[model samples]
Target: GGLSNLLFKCALPEHILSVGDEPRQVLLRVYGAILQVSASGAGIPPDWQPPPRPAAPEQLQGSGLCRHLPPGPGLAAAPRLLRPQGVDSLVLESVMFAILAERALGPRLYGVFPQGRLEQYIPSRRLRTEDLRDPDISKEIAVKMSRFHGMVMPFNKEPKWLFGTMEWYLKQILELTFPEEEQLKKFNHLKTYNLQEEMKSLRELLESTPSPVVFCHNDVQEGNILLLAGHEASSSDKLMLIDFEYSSYNYRGFDIGNHFCEWVYNYTHDSWPFFKASAENYPSRQQQLHFIRHYLSEDSGRRGDTTHEEQARIEEEMLTEINRFALASHFFWGLWSILQAKISTIKFGYL
Candidate 1:
């Protein structure tokens, strides 16, 4: 309870949402999900139960984090999604704008802005480390992908922000924490060489397409997604993707590639029961082929052109990226997690 991070719950018109604060304050980041908290409020919206009002202004000040954001009189968190940003405060701002704006086009987004109701945090319910997996999530994911790509304007900038720029940042995180200079050296070399070649190939790949970029959510972890379903009996469902801190202008393939890799990894890492609950027998290696085929079909230019050598080449490259990403996964996580573990140990000693 004494930890720096604080959680706040905000109320939107369509849904009751939750947000989190950074340790202490300053760059106050809001989580775009539901959480559990207890507080009281007034002037609350009718849709959701309004939180209790703050007894004093000092409590509402909230460690004086972001002066721009509205204060919650008193707020209690409810059970909702909680997705944190990996980057700094500035990046978090951009991410929120890009994502919330894109969602504004559809009613499903549920407004998150200066417009939300009086908010507060109550501790009645606590958000779990993870959420229960949903069955129709994939179909919902596809539609959300389409919606995001459909909304938002393209990014045009000089010097260019390459697809893996975020990965580069993550690599920096890895290097900072990674021990064993040899491991660092090997990864740096591998990344440096692959990045150069990948950038070159990516540039060429983009040359053939004149499509404008959409506000891209570079990371689509399940924690960052919210489902909007009309009813249990109805087939209707839509998803709102949150956490755009790494929002950037790049090839749509980059986003697709990451999400594709995510699914592959998600299915694999899940326990057998977790895997089955998500539906279907676990994806066999051959099922990956069908997934790839489905992915390629999204390329409008490559449609009905299975025989086209150029398209074939692109598909091959995508497959290659997947394999490379898979292999690099351990390298990245190992580096970051290792540093965190080591630092944590040194700071407090073995718990």
Candidate 2:
């Protein structure tokens, strides 16, 4: 049902269920892509084990939740070693963010592994496509997004992660050679677009528009949002955002605008194309303003200090910013879905 990762619900055995402080249940996420190829086989072979996790000195050094938070007592004395040979940089980076997320913002983490980690299994339901348009839910999301944007990460503040990844995806798409006749037929539709030219045009277009850089939860669709058990959508803190696989420092408008585009996508479709996207369902101007207002009001200090004229100017600029960056969101996923069609094992029709 998901791309990139596999999730499993693990329950503690009866004997140990109540013993110690370990969680009774944990969510296991097996990382994607890089974990597929091994020296001995194409995928994870039986009897494989994760390398030992780093400790102490390897503690996360960054912004966001980890900025003021102290290292948990669990991070006690342990041996440290150089980065292992097989582990890629992306996996290591995600592991660091996952650890930081659990400490202050996300669900509590139980264990970390080379491929994935054990996280607290929250009893919740994912928000549906329709839920993203609800005024109350929309306001809450804006507030949370503002909070996320306020923090700075250790990475370069420039929005390189956006165009860099798009460039990589475009390169992969352009290099595909489809040698087999059957493979050529299967992917012939890809010839319709000049992805290289399209990407150049898109990068230039986005570069001309101005937006602030921030640490963004790049994927903020309905499926990634959770409504905790016993809490209704109306509750102030009921919603929680999960999945930081694509999280990075990027343009602020891309984060907000991408979410607006998600209001039309229903990923639960049961047939070909595998999802439904209706452009007519895009948020109205009033709805966008409502969300932007909450986003700006999130920081009480900033909100209280701004004069009415300055607030109006800021709001108008953000409105324009959000609209322009929506194009970036479209260009990004168009390239991303094409690459996913080639590499991903997931059944969804990413193309």
Candidate 3:
């Protein structure tokens, strides 16, 4: 369900279940696409071919780009999640997972290692892009997100996660050297955009909007959401959010706005590039209001037992904040893809 990691479903031996509390099955995640391929040192299969480069930058910007490519063998390797130094990223991630599990906001963590983890395997299926538009499902997601944002985490809460990570990725993009003619051509195209200036402007725009800092899932696209099997669509527990590797304390608007941008993308395409973006499918204002209403209802911190008029004003301000932060989502992922293109040996067309 993710482009950056490889997941495997593992079943425990029959005799092990006698312990009673042991999970019968677990999900194994091997982090870093290229690492998944090289862990065994065999590298990518010789017959596999790299996908074609993406279309013009203008076209991609007009319509978003999504990496929904199916998992494939990879060749090269690179560092995993970008994080601030001093603290160990893997240890910090494990702590976050443990906390979420204790709070019932995410899957239970079974085991953690240098390069991957074992997690509780929820019996569920991923929600598709269109499922986000479902009235009941959208409302439930809003409620869960409200709770997610309310969580008091131990991580730094200065709201620097988005900007810092994006700046790091930008540095990687700028420092990359593509000596191959074709690769250089792609690099040249990327050079046309002043990414540094774009980042500065985006930061200023989002700061002016003033969204609250809170714990965020960071990546809430359909692939990361699972609808538990046997639960009715109206059930409160129907949906679960997974893949918190990128989770951090950040602006609330970035989380919600990034999710809204996902409404226009379908990542399940089976062909080369393996994603489709229909800008027209972006949610209408009415739809946005519906989601916001449910979110505000559950968010006591924001709603604050205020009068209806006060709540209405809050909602109106949030609508503007969310839409503006959507641009930051674009900038964040755009830099990510560029770096992945240079270092990841995964077969997807990151460019």
- On TM-score, the candidate that comes out on top is 3
TM-score for every candidate vs. truth? 0.45, 0.80, 0.83
Residue 164 shift from truth in candidate 1, angstroms: 6.4
Cα-based lDDT for every prediction = 0.39, 0.67, 0.74
- Model 2 stretches astray by more than 4 angstroms: 1-3, 15-17, 37-103, 179-192, 300-304
Residue 156 deviation, candidate 3, in Å?
Answer: 0.8
For all candidates, what are the clash counts? Answer: 33, 0, 0
TM-score of 2: 0.80
RMSD (Cα, Å) for all candidates, in order, is 13.3, 10.0, 9.6
Rank order (by TM-score, best first): 3, 2, 1
* Lowest-sum lDDT 10-residue window in model 2: 74-83
Which residue pairs come into collision in candidate 2? none
Which scores higher on lDDT, 2 or 3?
A: 3
lDDT of 2 at 8: 54
State how far residue 86 of model 1 sits from its true place (Å). 13
Tens digit per residue, CA lDDT, model 1, 1-351: 111123433222233233563122222234321122101111112123223332222233322323333322222221221112222333344445644555463222232342132222222221111322233445445555655655544344321344344344344343342354754565555455565455455456456543345555556645445444343423534445544544555545556545544543332224432222232433334544454554455545424455678766766665555544443333333333322332221121111
Candidate 2 C-alpha lDDT tens digits along 231-276: 8646899888776656778999999999999998987788977689
